[model samples]
Target: MSGTTRSGIPLADVYTAADVTAEPAPPGTAPYTRGISPGGYNDRMWVMGQYGGFGSAAETNARFKRLLDQGQTGFSVALDLPTQLGLDSDDPRALGEVGRVGVPIDSLADFETLFDGIPLSQVKQIRTTANSIGPLWVALVTAFAEKRGTDPNDIAIFIQNDVLKEYVARGTQIFPPEAGLRMAADVVEHTAAHLPNWTPMALSSYHIRESGADAAQEVSMTLSNTVAYLDEVVRRGVDIDQFADKLFMFLSAGMDLLEEVAKFRAARTAWSRLLESRYHAGADARALQIFSYTAGSSLTAQSPHTNIVRVTIEALAAVLGGVQTLNTSSYDEALGTPTLESVTLALRTQQVLAEETSLAKVADPLGGSYVVESLTGQILARVEADMDVIAEHGGALRCIESGWFAERLSQQAYEDQQNVESGARRVLGVNCFIDDSTIEVPAFSVDPSAEEQQRKRIAQTRADRDQSEVDVALDEVRRAARHGENCIGSITAAVRVYATVGEIYGVLREVHGPYTAHTGLG
Candidate 1:
């Protein structure tokens, strides 16, 4: 019944050994066309993470505990928009937004409050959804260790420390690209030197897809950005093997069923080749690709209840695609942040697949399928072609600097919006099956006064802390930035002295200036 993508490439009806351009290697081998790790689910189940953040630190902590109690295997913390943009909670530009989208974190106190009773030592993994607040992560971990009476190096943290993408695409950037990248390098160097096992970078393809790139484009752009980071670190005279092993991948699985599955397979193949051929990385680093949560952008506002079915399909795709970690978006994501009920349902979605579905019993069940193998081959070719185009233009960062990549993405976004508006693309409940009287799903609501309370917290933190210590810390941060020393160490110490996020980022801006993305289409 199925044909091909809208681009009119023929869909291979079935796949065989002859159909795949390269013969499928055994799982855990070079290329990883089958899978990356051996004894896939038997050795480890995909990290099942739940994304939620809202209200006060105490309130969000309660929510975090509740999810963990509900069978969530790991935690993925979400920060408010102000936090994401590196602004203090009380900044005027942050008006009407505190805790509206995610949790409010203004100071180290807030971090402690949010993690009050959570056992950092015993938790499987904790992903801090961060970009601009890379320094905050270091401070938070240090504080957590001091409180637990353990070495901070024992903790695991995967920060979304991909700042260049934030500058060009997400608009969550606070410092200039050069400076922001320097801060990221600090995190990479610090984590590699200290934390050792913790992953410092999760080169995010989630935002790329959210911004309107297709699945193949998403994989290509992410790898291109991965190359950009490797270039930055190699120029710093660090060994790629040491740092690249700690770099992981973050991708999105939307509603495109087969395409999404093939995307993951293609990503594994491309990442291995990129690491081995381009970076001269060995098997240890080439075999490691830490995959994480799929974003909620694919959810539809109309007939929102149908999103459950959609999420289930995406979860299955991620698993069959051989992801090491996976997060299923809440069904009611479009209207608001997930309610506790919605979050539990999302976690249960993964639990059910693990316990009930036969999918977990076998590794790469689709590995030998004629159609799946053929699709994976084509996707790998397309990704390579796209990477070639990026290289011709001088890599991903250069493309972002020249505004070529963003312009292509912007055009794709424009076309997608038009497609939905004109019915050329059908979003199940949104554009295709509409009914005026269809039942409305209840949307999650946040307290309107939450922003005011968050501001009060920010003010209290500043007043209660030693002002001179903050000044000294902030000065040191700027000095580190100027000297090309590891800025994360300085920023980390500064935050412990109650330096507001804005204050630390302001120091970076002072030294390195702010990045201004090219607003005009080229």
Candidate 2:
């Protein structure tokens, strides 16, 4: 209470109504500060989506079934590094990382195995982190649906396809910035023409926050990046109204209770104003839908049980902030994959908040609070100021391509760590509460044999398919990429022929070339 917010917004003691800049408008109105939905959870509860996936296809399939049985309403796939990078299980580079942190998926055959018994129509949403290979990921899902005699339009899907964020905050980028933007737009264009229920983009601020962005900076970068995508998509002659309303955002729910809540409120305020004023967006597009995963960066390995308390606070802020979908991080995730027990505990946390607290009865539980309102206004102002700086530096894409965004994020990260080391910031088990005590926390481990099984599966897929059909499909994909045609159609064709993810990406690599590191543009 004595210090400023993580983003340097000043904190005051005993806020009064005098501190609030504007009086309240009703929820679901213009400049939507109170909440997006008029009735909020009183009408429909937010979807509880706990993120989990690990090891081989069959192993992860069992985990998905278990999660669905435990009352999870959606899917949040965490792809392994190799899969995230578009590498196959048999690739030499994928040897050590085949199935370490998340699920390994090489082709449609793997998806067939991964969702063997799960019904696609029954799931509310299926979201994954597929930035660089977003177009491929969407095609694979559509192909899998066709294989099972399900219409792709009936199954709601979401892909985290913010490729610009990959260049700055995450390291899985496989294309140049300009080329990546084009690929992301290709998904939007193809989705608009084909799968109407699918959301091809989930603009991400979660990674930016984890990479050391504060609340205000997180809001600024996210909106700035949104502009880049909107410009590209609309440039393709696609009407903004048709697909803009379906766009999703992924943000962080941090540990700071009041500021985190204020951040979400501010994000909603800024986004609504931008869409209405800039793009002439309608009511549906202005009501922003947010998906938050509790700050994974906040979890401490020292006293891992303390993470339960951390996630609870973060998830509470997300609910108060009025998210459409939410996932709570498991306590043991920092140490290893979460055990089933830990995952259930995480899900039950949301159940208690939704069912027992009676917090869902009101639209905006903290709507008119003097402190919340004041903090929300202040955070929005800071976000706008930061956006001005981003514009002055030639916008988000320029900042990322020139390494300006990376430089700023690294600077903030360095300062934050310095504060913790110097005791300016006190973390519960990390800096304070010093003891010689050791904590034992249970975790889930990957089986060593999973890698070999994955390799054999990939080999069998290759041996079983017609090489001539795959060759023709790959050639068509290269043609689409070269001729500036939307590549989703051809990519889906390739996946149907059992062309591996790496093979599809390999074709693009030849056409677009690999990415080279950027030095700051001075």
Candidate 3:
């Protein structure tokens, strides 16, 4: 049999032990390339996280219960762009966007509405796509703790707080990269001290891939950002072990199953080595490097039903890749956010894998394969080369500031699109197979008046809350920002005083200034 590389490099007929890196240590030990857990899924299966979004808080909460009832182990919450960017639903820029893509959150009141019946203490873990609104995210968590009658120390949160990538790729950033990094570090330090069970910042490569990065580029960029965060936190005098263990990873599992598995394995190995060499973090800090995977940007829009088959394959790759958590994307995501049915199908995909397939019964089943081991080594070597480039460009922050990162990804994306359009890349049912007769596609519709209703809600929230209290909270937060105090505490104080998400963000906007995309650097 013959094999090929992801970038079309020809694979040799065989590989020896020397071809692969020397086994640094045993599985579940330091430098965990073999695997993070020796028992693997035999001990505990990966946390099966499903992404759910809907137009209304009531609708989203109902679907969340339905998914949990169907055996989902973790919950991933998707907020609308305005909410994620810390805009009140009533803002003019937010007019046409509220609840169009994800759930609309206007205030602490809307947050309360979203998780009304669900008890936070009983849930395993919760993930959010929050970046620019990092302070608001902290506030919301604090409010949840108050309502649930549990200490903020007990609740678990995995916020996608990678602000540099948000500005450079996703277009959801509200502040400059410097201020954003400061907020992420604040979350890291705060969660380490208060919420030991929580994962505060999830350095996300999933969106970088969605922004059109290839496997090697995605791995390199994400790991570089991770190292940047580590450097910042250590420079701020936070101990490496104190916050490194709290740093989780959010990655993507694309159509390349073997490459995906190899990527995860290599990522953990590289991360472990980086920590050991750079910071001298202990085994416990390096061993439990939590990773979560989402379905990638490879799936299509035409034959939407085929995306189920696509997502199942991607989920399997994540499982085999030893992900600690996984989020299966909806089949109908291309058109818009997922409907309840599509979301449930996504959740059930993981359930079937967890319960029916013996896939979870073994760990690192591909650990000894000649092809997989060889590919893992190749991927790591490429990632290291990419890292050298990032370092030469003065790290990820400088790369983004220089626009080199975006230019490279844009070229890759254009090539990928060209490949698909020219039939060089065959996406089944899209560029090939051309089956118009056998398709029974589901009709997806976002709530027609969701934007209007969201605006009214935001207006009513502004009218209802005491303006004097809001002023006091914002002033205190601004003072904290100037003094270089932990912004998490200031955010919590503001939210306790009933400050809206928009108001809290407005304070940061005044202090930190918004990010402007660089055009000339490319």
Candidate 4:
């Protein structure tokens, strides 16, 4: 290779054991650079998850059944902008946005409808893209389990509760950073004590990567954010060993085969070392649960069929990288929400890898390669250097508050785009391949009635619910938010009364106020 990798790491012509800087180790050992599981996919294939959800709850529920019927090992739900912001479908702010991006959940009734006919224990795990309303989502899940007469301990939930990323990457943050961190930690504390099978949060680098962070920046920023969360939770009396194992990671699997695999190994090395050094967490706590989604940013609009090949490469990278779970992107995602055909094909892509190919039979098949091992050490050094900058700037929280973090990412994003536009980088079908004809593919769209139906459903729920009970429940939530207490219990009480998602968050808004974005630190 003559040029640099996507993250700007130089590629060497030839490599040997001497080129590798990091010490070699076997699978399932300390630092975990080679791999996490000794048996790897032979012990069990990485959990195959397909992420999807859009339109009304009933519509989303039917889609969930489709994935379940297809033998999806895990289910991942993508909530709409309104629900992610904790707004009801009827709210004026949600008028044009209800069910636009993903499923709209306004009340507990909508939640039940979202998973109707699908049992809580149907999949190995169920995950959601809930940040600002993460605790409320967990509360709804547990309440649903109770209503279905299932033991809460029997189910597993992996929520994307890392709100700090929202502050740095973009918007949709409901509370200020400090308050948001506190609430995110509350979910961890509550889940550790109550739902042992659940993953409180997935420190997410996926969005950061999608927002234009290179591989090294992605891992560094994510780890810095992880440190901030650990400090806050431990201050609240959460024992590190007890809840550290509950930590999960959500990362992007990009098309750089060597770099992606190297990034994965280096991330594990950093995480395992951090836990051992900081809190004296044992092996179990250092072992991370990683859920990966193939990079949607790599999909192209022209010659959409090419995406099938693109996603396959990314998915293979994630597998070879030793991720515990994977979600392959649909080929038609660049055009619109994926159609049933495309979604099924995406699921089949993973099935073919596991069953047909012998890819899953070995543990770290590329572990001994000179190029991969050298790249792994290089990526880790870059990550640590950047992490040192974060620490020097007074940590993740200060960087965000001062807008240094946001500004740095913006500059990096601009530089990355400039490289592509200037022909320094080539994107197949986009820049290099001159395809004049448009290739059409079937695309899925949310139903127009989904919005109106969601509104009426929430209105009906509000009327049918006992007013006095809901009032009491919401008051307690207000009290918890005001008193700096863990809001999970109060949120759960409110969820049981069929309280609207907007209602609970509305009480929180009254206490914490709406969040406004910070301008860059100059």
Candidate 5:
């Protein structure tokens, strides 16, 4: 039967070698079309990086330890809205939101509490998604490292510090586009010089996809943002090879199984060629390493129990797509923050896929299929065309500032909703199958006292710290910001003195001024 992929690429019924023109490179070779590693999971299985964090520091710490005990190799942190917005939990704007969506962190003390007894050396990696206040998070992490007597260069820390995507899709942005780009570039430069094991920026397409871009638009927009970041950092005088290998990419594994797999393969080859042609990057610098999160938008609230099956299929697609790390969403994601029971099921989903299915035994298992190969070629071509449109608008930043990117994504999202409502697209439990049975899954709730407790702690922390030293360090931060120097060193110094996130951000806001956009960009 003939059909079309989710990105609207037509699929043929059958296939043969005659349909394939250019042969794929062997696994572990340059361009990395077949796969990044020759043995794939046979050499080493992908990291089971589960994204989690909520409530108070102690509660989040307990959750982290539980996941580690359950064979989770890496941990991904989700900071609350206040922390991501560079506000203290006690701020008037942060009152109701503190610890509501994720963990509330106001200073280095909270970072220590969040990590508590977990040895940084043993944890494979700690991935955090913090855009506007990423530098603050990095400083807090560095301070935590110093206190633990661990070398900062020895730990694997990955920060999603891409502010450009914030403008296009997500909305946690603090500074204007230019100032935000400067902040991102400063972190990149600082990490390249000091932290050899840290990936300073994870160019993320996950948020874009969650924002409702189709697969082709997702890849194109992400690559365009990458180009913008590279151009900014290159102008800052850093060599391409020095920080290129340290950069990682994050994408979403949606429910369209074959389309998601093909998108990943196409992304690898396209990124390799872009690096070589545009930046003259070498072999090692051209490798496209990816960490994927299962699409949160695909979950259905109609029958929350069925989300377990959805997560399983999405996780399988990520594995087949050759993702370096995978995160599966909990079954109760559409209902609320995942309960411990749901989180356990999500982690078990990965284990079942890795150990029971035997899918990881070979690299690029579907490499020779005519349908897969054709889909990969089609995705690449469409992505290139969309990228060309971005170039016409003066690149990703320009498209964002002009509202073109946001407008396009909104249009696509509207179209998708209309498709489901009109029965043009079938969303199993949501639109297609009518279910009258009421199956109730337990909902996860944050502590009602969490906000009050967090506020008291912040107040006590401020009263206990040396106020004069905080003033001195904050002055240095303002000086660095005013003088166009890399602010990371100064921020790290301020964090060591126990400067709160809001305090440091206050100085930056005074110096850089708050970003004002008229285009509804964020």
Candidate 6:
């Protein structure tokens, strides 16, 4: 009997060498189907990263220190919606939202408080999930480093500067599509020349998957978005090799165990081929690095404890698929912001998977399995076809601007919701296994006074800073944005002079204009 994968690819019951038409490469070879590193985890284990940020900067700093002390190798930041939208905590547009979902960072002072006693130089990687305001985060980090007498070049920063994905999936976009692309590419060009150790752009399929794209759509759309970014940067006079190696991709580990693994393996293979054949990227550039977070959408509010098991399984899939970095969603994430106990449990999940399991000893442990290999090949082919469709629509940027991509994802999201409602897709606690148990998961809540405190701080900062110098710096940034010049340096200068995130973004907002999603397409 034949079956179908979650991505709607046909699957065979059994397979032989006949199923594998292409030459099988080793773990470290180009078009890395097996794995990227020759030694794999034997040389170094994947970074155990935890995604966190909430309330005030001091509170988030304490959480970061606790996670680091508990053996988290890397840390990821989640900025509040107000910060992500380039509004100050005190802005009328930001009422009731400051420090609610994530940390509220209004100025360099907030960044300082966020990092506090943590030595950023020792952190393996600092991943910030900021899209439209990504350059501001970069500037804050650079200024913070300089204040502490640390060279920004020594820090390994990964910014989710994939603004195109923001337009299609996440709705935190600020500027219009064309201008957003320019800002995203500007970060790549600036970081290539300045921060040598930083990975400027993390092409995120995670949010796309969470927004309801299937495995195939997630991988294909991400790669197509990467193509848009690569073209933009190359047009700015940067070599393919210069910035390609610094690029990274983020995928989502969902409930389909084998299919999730296959999706990742196929992504590595597809990325390698695309870079080599199209961009002429060298070996280092072709060896794509992936970071994955277990799917937040997969967690169920009903029987929230079951989410722990779901996260473990997804994290295992990421490890088996050879992810370079992994973050497991907390069990209580479906309820609200993760409580301290829940986040600790999430970190322990990674620790146990890395320390107690023998799965990491070998690279691509399931590389030769009949089912896995067959699925991998099928996903690669399907993703390529999806890419062709995207190209036919005049590429990723055009599709995004015209709302084609948004319409497709919205339809898929509607269908998935319908499936769950009709009992076509079985979610254990949500749809199938009815339970009378009370929901007892402890969820984190932000202090109501956090907004007031942030407002007072920003007001004090404005009173203390040299108003003349701040005006000059803001003007330089405005000039750079208006004149089509690289704005990273000017933005950094503004950040150093105590300019607020809202101030810098306000300048750009004036230049590029705001973006509102077109609702007519859906």
Let me know the TM-score candidate 2 reaches against the reference structure.
Answer: 0.98
lDDT of 3 by residue, 63-99 (tens): 8888878777678888888888888877777878888
Q: TM-scores of the models, in the given order?
A: 0.96, 0.98, 0.95, 0.98, 0.98, 0.98
Clash pairs for candidate 3: none
Candidate 4 clashes between residue pairs 3 or more apart in a chain or in different chains:
none
Candidate 2 local lDDT, 291-372, one digit each (tens): 9999999998888989999999999999998888999999998898889899989999998999899778888888888888
Per-residue error (Å), model 1, residue 65: 0.5
Per-residue lDDT of candidate 4, residues 201-309 (tens digit): 9999998898888998899999999999999888888889889888878889999999999899889998998899888888988877688999998998888999999
For candidate 3, what is the total of clashing residue pairs?
Answer: 0
Model 4 gets an lDDT of 0.88
Q: Give candidate 2's error at residue 430 in angstroms.
A: 0.9
Write candidate 1's Cα lDDT for 1-522 as tens digits: 356663334666554577767567887887887777766687778888887788878888998888888777778888889888888887888888889878988878898899889876667778877886776677777765776688877766777788877755688887766677767777887777777878788889888888878778888988888877778778888888887877778888766667777778878888889898988998878875656565577688877888899899888888888888788888888888888888898899999999998888787878777677777888888999999998999887778878887888889889989988899877887788786667677777888888888888888998999999999989898888889787777877887788888888778778888778776654
lDDT agreement with native, every candidate: 0.80, 0.89, 0.79, 0.88, 0.89, 0.90
Q: Best by lDDT, which number?
A: 6
Candidate 1's displacement at residue 180, Å, is 1.6
* CA displacement after TM-score superposition, residue 403 of candidate 6 (Å): 0.3
Give the clashing pairs for model 2.
none
Candidate 5 lDDT over 1-522, as tens digits, reads 587888788777887777676778987887887778898888778989888889999999999999899899998998999999899999999979999789999998888899999987888889998889878877988888998888898888999999999987889999888889889988898898888678899899999998879998899999999999999889989999999988888999998898888899999988998999999999888988889999999999998888888899899889998988899999999998999888988999999988898789999888887878888888888888999999999999888888888888888999989999998888888887868899988889999999999999999889989999999999999999999999899999999989999999999999998877646635
* Steric collisions counted per model: 4, 0, 0, 0, 0, 0
CA lDDT, candidate 5, residue 198: 89
- Indicate the worst ten consecutive residues by lDDT in candidate 3: 1-10
Question: In candidate 1, where is summed lDDT lowest over 10 consecutive residues?
Answer: 1-10
Error of 3 at 70 (Å): 1.5
Mark the regions of model 6 whose C-alpha exceeds 4 Å error after superposition: none
State how far residue 264 of model 6 sits from its true place (Å).
0.7
